[model samples]
Target: MISWQARALNLFLKQTVKRSIENTKDVNKLRFQMRALDKFVFGTSSNIERSQSMREGTLCDEIKLKFSNSKKKLLYVHGGAFVFKTPAIHNNFIARLAEPLDLHAIVPDYPLAPEYPFPAALDSCYVIYKSLLDAGTLPEDIIIAGDSAGGNIALSLLLRARRNGLPMPNCCVLISPVADMTQSGLSSVENRYSDALFSLDVMLYCRNLYLEGANHDLHNEEISPLFADFTGLPPFMFHAGSTELMRDDSTRLAEFMQAHGVETHLQVWREMPHVFPLFEQLPESKAALQQIVDFIKKQQN
Candidate 1:
C-alpha cells in the first residue's frame, strides 16, 4: 500500500510538475524552470561539503558528508533527462547515502544534451572513471550510481569501461533508469496514466533533444543500454515504481543482467512516482534509501 504522503505527493505532482513538463515546449526554459522548482522544493544539503575539480578537462563536483572518513567513493551521475545539471534533490539523496555509508561522492557536471549530445556525456563520464582509477582508488572501493538519464549513463559507462578492459566498480545502483531509449517497454504504455511525474510525450521530447546531433540511433547499446552486452558488469541494484512509465526499463534490464550471470536486485514499489526515492518526505523513500545503503555495504563484504 502506498503511504498517504506518497499519495498526496503524487496528486500534487500530477497537477503541477506533470502539467508543467507537458506545457513546456522549449528545452532551455524547461531546464531553468525545473532547476528552480527543485531548489524551492528540495533545498541543497547543508551537511555535505561540496568542492569542484576538473577531470580530463570536464568540470566535476564532489560532495562528502561532514566528517565521513571512509576511503570508499561513490560516482553519482545526476539525472535531468540528459539536459539539466545535478539538482538539489540528488544532492540531498547523495548526502543521505554518504552519511550512512561514509562515502566520498563524485558528481560529474557533464555536458548537457541538444548542445553536447551522444558521445559527449558518455565520454566525459568515462574519463572521470578512468581518472578515479588512475588516482589509486581501488575499483572495489567505488560504487557507481545514477537516477533516470544518469542511470542510463552509469550503465553505458560500465559497458564502455569493460570494452576498454577497465575493472568494474564494486556495484551499481539505478533509480528509475531510462534504460530503453526506443520506448519499447510495455509500462511506457500500460502505466501512461498511473505515473504522475512523466508522460510519454515528455519522454519523447527529451529523447529527441538528447539525440539531436548524435551519430548513433536510439537502439545503440551505448545510448539505450537495454541492447548492450552485460557479460562482465558488476552487481546491480535497481529501484523503480510499478506505476512508472519506464518501470520496465529497470525490470527488463535487471532480468537481462541476471540472465547474463550478473547479480541484480530489483525493487518495484507499488503506485509510487518515478524515482520516488528522490522525494525524501515519503516513508517509502526512507526504506528505499536504506536498501541502497545496505546493498552497497553487502558489496563491500
Candidate 2:
C-alpha cells in the first residue's frame, strides 16, 4: 500500500509543481522558478558538511561524513533535464546517502543544455571519472550515481568509459533516469496523466533544448543510453515510480542490461512520484533509501 504521505505529495506535485512546469515555456524562467521552489521546500541548512573542489577543471561539491577516512567515492550527477545544476533536494539526498554509506560524494556542477549541450555534460563527467582513477582511486572503490537527466550522464559516462577500455566502477545507481531520449517508451504515453511530476510536453521540451544544435538525433547512443550496447557495464540498481512517464526507461534498460549479462536490479514503486526518494517526508522514501544503502553495501562485498 502506498503511504498517505506519498499520496498527498503526489497530489501536491500534480496540482502545483506539474502545473508550473506545463505553464512555463522559457527554460530560464522554469530554472529560476525551480531554484526558488527547491529553496523553499528543502531549505538551506544541512547536517552534512559540504566543500567545493575541482576535479579535471570541473567544480564539484564534495560531501561526506565529518572526519571520514574512506577511500571510496560516489560521483553524483544532478538532474535538471540537463539544464539546471544541483538543487537543495539533490544536495540533501546525496548527504543522506553519503552519511550512512560512508562515501566521499563528489557532485560535479556540469555544464547545462542549450548553451553547452550533448557531449559537453558527458565529457565533463568522464573527465572526473578519469581524474579519480588518476589519483590512485581504485575502480572497485568508486560507484557512480545520478537521478533523472543526471542518470543519463552517469550511464552514458560508463558506456563511454567502456568503449575507451577504462575499468568500470563498482556499480551504478539510477533514480528515475531519463534513459530514453526518443520518449518512445510505452509509459511515456500510457502514464501521461498518472505521472505527477513530469508531463509529456515538458519532457519533449527539455529534450529539444538539450539536443538543439547537436549533430546527433534523439537516437544517438550518447543521447539515449537505452539504445546503446551494455555489454560490459557495471552492475546497476534502478528505482522508478510505476506511474512515472519514464518508468520503462528504467525497466527496459535493466532488462536489456541483464540480457547482456550485466547484474541489474530494477524496483518500481506503486503510485510513487518521480524520484520519490528525494522527498524525505514520504515513508516510502525512507524504505527506498535503505534499499539503496543495502545495494551499495552488497556491491562492496
Candidate 3:
C-alpha cells in the first residue's frame, strides 16, 4: 500500500507540478516554474548529516559517517530532467544509502541542459569516472548510481567507459531512470495521468532543452543507453514506481540487459511516484533502500 505521505506528495504535485505544466507552454517558462517549485522539493531532512564541496571542479557533498577501512565508494548522480538543478534531497538520499555501508557517495553536479546541451553533462560524468580510476580507486569497489535523468547519465557513463575499454563499476543502482530520451516507451503515454510527477508534454519540453537544436540522433546509444550493447557491463539493480511514466524504461532496459547475458534486477513499487526512494519518511522508501543496500553488498561479496 502507498503511504499517506506519498499520497499527500502526489496531491501536492498534482496541484503544483501538473497545474504549472498545463499553464506553461514555452520551455523556458516551464523551467522557470519548475525552478520555483524545486525550492520546496529540495528541502533537507533532519536525519542526514551532509556537507557539500567542490571536487575536481564537480560540485559534490560528503555524508559524515564512519565505516571500516573499506575502499568502497559511490558516484551518485542527481536528476532534474536535464535542466532542473540538484537539490538537497538528492544529497539526503545519497547519505541515507551510503552511511549504512560506510560507502562514500561523490555526487557530481554535471552541467544542466538548454545551456550545456546533450554531450556536456555526459562528458562531465565520464571525466569524473575516469578521474576516480586514475586516482587508484578500483573500478570494482565503486558503485555508480542515479535517479531519473541522473540514472540516464549513470547508464550512459558505463556505456561510454565500456566503449572506450575502461574498467567497469562493481554495480549500478537506478531509480526511475529515463533510459530512452526518445520517450518511445509505452508507459510514457499510458502512465501519463498515473505518474504524478511527469507528463509527456513535460518530458518533451525537457528533451528539447537537452537537445538544444543540435542534430544529434535521439536513438543514438550514447543518448539513450536502451539502444547500447550491455555485454561486459556490471550488474544492474533498477527501482521504479509502477505508476511512473518511466516504468517501462526500467523494464525494457532490464530485458535488453538480460537478453545480452548481463545480470539485472528490476523492482517495481505499486502506485508509487517517480524516484520514490527519495521519500525517506515512507516505509516503502526504506524498504527500497534496503534492497539497494543488499544489492551493493552482494556485489562486494
Candidate 4:
C-alpha cells in the first residue's frame, strides 16, 4: 500500500510537474523547475558524502555515491532527456539505490541539448564510462541504471560499450525509461494524458533539440537497443508503472530480451506513476526498492 504521504506528494508532484510543463515556454524554464526541486523535492539525508569527478576537461556531476562501501560498483546515469535534471534535484531518488545496495554510484551531470546537442550527452556518458574503466573500475562489478531519460542513456551506453568491445556490466536497471527518444511508441501517445509529469509536446521538443541534425537512423540498434541484439549483455530488471505513460517501453523491452534468451525481470506496479521509488519512505516505494536490491544481489550470485 502507498503511504498517505506518498499519495499526497505524488499528487503534489503530478499537479506541479504538469503545470510546469504547460506554463514553461522553453528548455531553460524546464531547467528552472529541476533547480527549484533541488530545494523542494531533492532535499534528503545530507549526512551522505558527495564528491566531484571530471573528464576530458569538462566538469561532470560525479558523486562519491553513498550506495554502500561494499565494492566500487555501478556506473549510474541520471535521466533528464538530455535537457534537464541534476544530482541535487535527484538526490532524493539516488540515495535509495546508494544506501541499500552499498553501491558506489558515479553519476555524471552530462551536457544537455539546445546547448550541447546530439551525441554530446550520449558521448559524455561514454566518456565517463571509459574513464571509470580506465580508473580501475571493473566492468564485472559495474551495473548501470537510469530512470526516464536516464534509462535511455544507460541502455544506449551499454550498446555502445558492446559495440566497442568493452566488457559488459554485471546487470542494468531501468526505471520508467524513455528508451525510444523518437517517442514513436504507442504509449507515448496512448498515455500522453495518463502520466502527470510528462507531455507529448514537451517530449517532442526535447527530442528535436537533442537530435539536432544527427542521423535519424531509427533502425540503428544504438538508437533503440530494444530493437538491437541484447544477447550476452548483463542481466536486467526494469520497473515501470502500469499507469505510467511509458509503461509499454518496459513491457515490450522485457519481451524482446527474453525472446533473445536474455535474463530479464519486469515489474509493473498498478496505479504507480513514473519513478515512484524515489518516495521510498512510502510503503509501496520501499517494496520497489527491495525488488531492485534483490535483483542486484541476484546478479552478484
lDDT of 2 by residue, 10-126 (tens): 998888878888845688877876786586345423546789998888899999888888899999998888887546788888888998888999999998888887888999999
Better of 2 and 4 by lDDT: 2
Off by over 4 Å in 1: 40-47, 213-215
Better model by TM-score: candidate 1 vs candidate 4? 1
> Order of all candidates by TM-score, from best down to worst?
2, 1, 3, 4
Looking at model 4, report the run of 10 residues with the lowest lDDT sum.
60-69
Each model's lDDT: 0.88, 0.88, 0.84, 0.75
Runs of candidate 2 with Cα error greater than 4 angstroms are 40-47, 213-215
Q: What is the per-residue lDDT of model 4 for residues 131-194, given as tens digits with 9 covering 90 to 100?
A: 7787787877788888887888888888898889888888998998877655667888778777
Whole-model lDDT, model 1: 0.88
Model 3: worst 10 consecutive residues (lDDT sum): 40-49
Clashes of each: 0, 0, 0, 6
In model 3, the runs with Cα more than 4 Å from the true position are 23-49, 64-70
At residue 15, what lDDT does model 1 achieve?
89
Which is the better candidate, 2 or 3, if ranked by lDDT?
Answer: 2
Candidate 1 per-residue C-alpha lDDT over 161-180 given as tens digits, one digit per residue, 9 for 90 to 100: 99999999999999999889
Q: Give candidate 2's whole-model lDDT.
A: 0.88
Q: What value of lDDT does candidate 3 attain over all alpha carbons?
A: 0.84
TM-score of each: 0.95, 0.96, 0.92, 0.89
